[model samples]
Target: MQPTVQPFFESVTGTVTYVVFRSGHPECAVIDPVLNYDPKAGRTSTTDAHRVVEFVRQHGLQVQWILETHAHADHLSAAQYLRHELGGAVAIGQHIRTVQSVFKTLFNLERGFRVDGSQFDHLFREGEKFSIGALAAKALYVPGHTPADTAYQIGDAVFVGDTLFMPDVGTARCDFPGGNARALYDSIRKLLALPGDTRLFMCHDYPPDGRKPEWETTVLAQREHNIHVHDGITEAQFVRMRETRDATLAMPVLMLPSIQVNIRAGEFPPVEENGQSYLKIPLNAL
Candidate 1:
């Protein structure tokens, strides 16, 4: 069955959150919704997520799930927030535990944070199949961008989080914790192995100046012309190229604050003795 997609653009975050519903059923799934967070002010808002909720309500859609392609390190997820409002479970790749384990030590977080990935409602394994509204989705463990990265294949659209970027912009950085250029090459190869007609829906896009951000493309197009990870590129060549490009890249603008919050399913760290939750910033730690 074909799916209907509603793309929600978060301007400041430059991320595309999609509301995907099976064509004949009113049941819907929300993918990678963003919770607006202002790190400078240490404040969080429900505006973006609420917009999605309002849309769901208006459409009389039964919220089936809040799907996260991976544990993000750039923006806060609205999964829990929407889960609370809509009574849907939050799900992510089972490998998210790898991310949780890595970041727990990196941030020197407290003992309370569980690395088993029990924090989310469900953790999907590679090749796992599930359904939303009559449409079936299979999880493809697409690591290398991050340890837990996944590509969700639903109907003709594949929700690829940070695995590939718009052609002109190239792909995501393999410099984040657990990211590997060599592994990324393998992941891209796996993605290209899909039906060439598969639609690729990326998690985020930072468009070049004078252009609007785009979140969707075709695997055929990527295979033929994705500048960085296209099909004819050798794995060693990809690693060399990816690393060189990453070296010149600055960290995600929201890296420090985003990771601390993201690993916790977008919830801010618990408020301390002073009654204010705190996020850690490691000096010269990248």
Candidate 2:
């Protein structure tokens, strides 16, 4: 059964959060939900998250899962908040433990932080099947945007987070820690290998030249038109282009803050002795 999906765009971070469910069914899953953040103020608010919550409530949807395609570096996750308000298991790829361990050292997080992928309610392995109401879903371990990126395949629609973007925009950057251009090319092949008509939903869209942001496209369109890796592009060609392009890019503005919070499934870092939660910014550590 094809799942019905609703997209909620958070423009500040250019993130697309999705609410997906089976037709005529109350059970649903929220994907990549965002929590609004004011970096200048060092504060987070749930206004964007509430919009999703409102939609679920208005539609009388039952949220069975709050899923993350990966630990995002562009925006804070609303998983914990949504799980609190909507009642669902917060889940991600089993490899999140790799992310947790890496960031645990990068951020020098307190000893209390666990690196076993225990922050999430469930850890999904590649090929694992689960149900969202009557809709059957499987997790595809499509890494390389980071070591933990995943794509959720629910029938014909695949929620590809930070994997492939719009045709003109190309694919995700591979310069982040643990990201590999070779691996990313292989992962994109896996995605493009899907049935030509399968719908591939993007997690973020950085529109160009007055174009409107889009979150959905087909496997065929990507194979034909994706500038970075079209049907004939070789693995060597993709890796070279990706590496060269990534070298010119800058680290995401919210990378530091987002990593810490996302590593904990969107929960803020523990309160400090000063009676306030703090996000550390390690000087000169990128």
Candidate 3:
């Protein structure tokens, strides 16, 4: 059975949050939900998440899982917030341990911080299968945007998080810590190998030429027209292009604060004696 997908775009961060479920079923899953953050003011609000919660309530959907494609840098995750309000297990790729390990040091997290990926309710293995109501979903490891990116394949649809963007946008950058252009090329190949008509959902969309945003496309379109890694694009060619482009790009605006909270499954650092949680920015550290 095909799943019903409703996308909620948070334009401020260029992030798209999806609510997916089998038709006629009350159980569902949310993928890549966003938590609103204002960097200038250093505050977080759940307006975006509340929209998701309201949608679920209106549709009589029971959230079964809150899934992350990866620990995102552009926007804060509402996984923990959604779980607390909607009652779903928060999950991510098992390789999140690799990310947690890297950032734990870079961020100089407290000694009590753990890198074992215990923060998430479930750590999905490559090809691991789980159920969203009656719909069977498989986890596909698609790292390189980050070491922990995983796409969820449910029926004919795949929720690709920052892997391949709309044909015009090309693909995700591979310059973040642990990101590799070659690995991303391989991962995109695996995604393109899906059936030609398979529907691919995106986690973000940055439109160009003043066009409106889009977050869904098909495998056939990607293999045929994706400017960065279409059918004839070789790995070496992709790596060179991706690396060069990444080098010219600036880090995501929310990278610093997002990573600190996201690695802890969206929980802020423990409140100090001052009774407030703070995010740290390490100087000269990427």
What RMSD, rounded to one decimal, does every model reach? 1.3, 0.7, 0.7
- Model 1 over residues 172-275: C-alpha lDDT tens digits? 88998889988888888888888888888988888989988898899899988888977778988889999998989888777888788777776778889999
lDDT of 2 by residue, 1-286 (tens): 6789999998989899999998899999999999999999998999999999999999999999999999999999999999989899999999999999999998888998999999899999998999999999999999889999999999899999998999999999989999999999999999999999999999999999799989899999999999999989999999999999999999999999999999899899999889999999999987
State in Å the error of residue 256, model 1: 1.6
Task: Tell me the tens digit of each residue's lDDT in model 3 across 1-286.
Answer: 6789999999999999999998899999999989999999999999999999999999999999999999999999998889889999999999999999999989889999999999999999999999998999999999999989999999999999989999999999999999999999999999999999999998888899889999999999999999999999999999999999999999899999999989888888999998989999899887
Candidate 2 global CA lDDT score: 0.94
- Write down the TM-score of every candidate: 0.96, 0.99, 0.99
Looking at model 1, report the run of 10 residues with the lowest lDDT sum.
258-267
Q: How far is 21's C-alpha from truth in model 3 (Å)?
A: 0.4
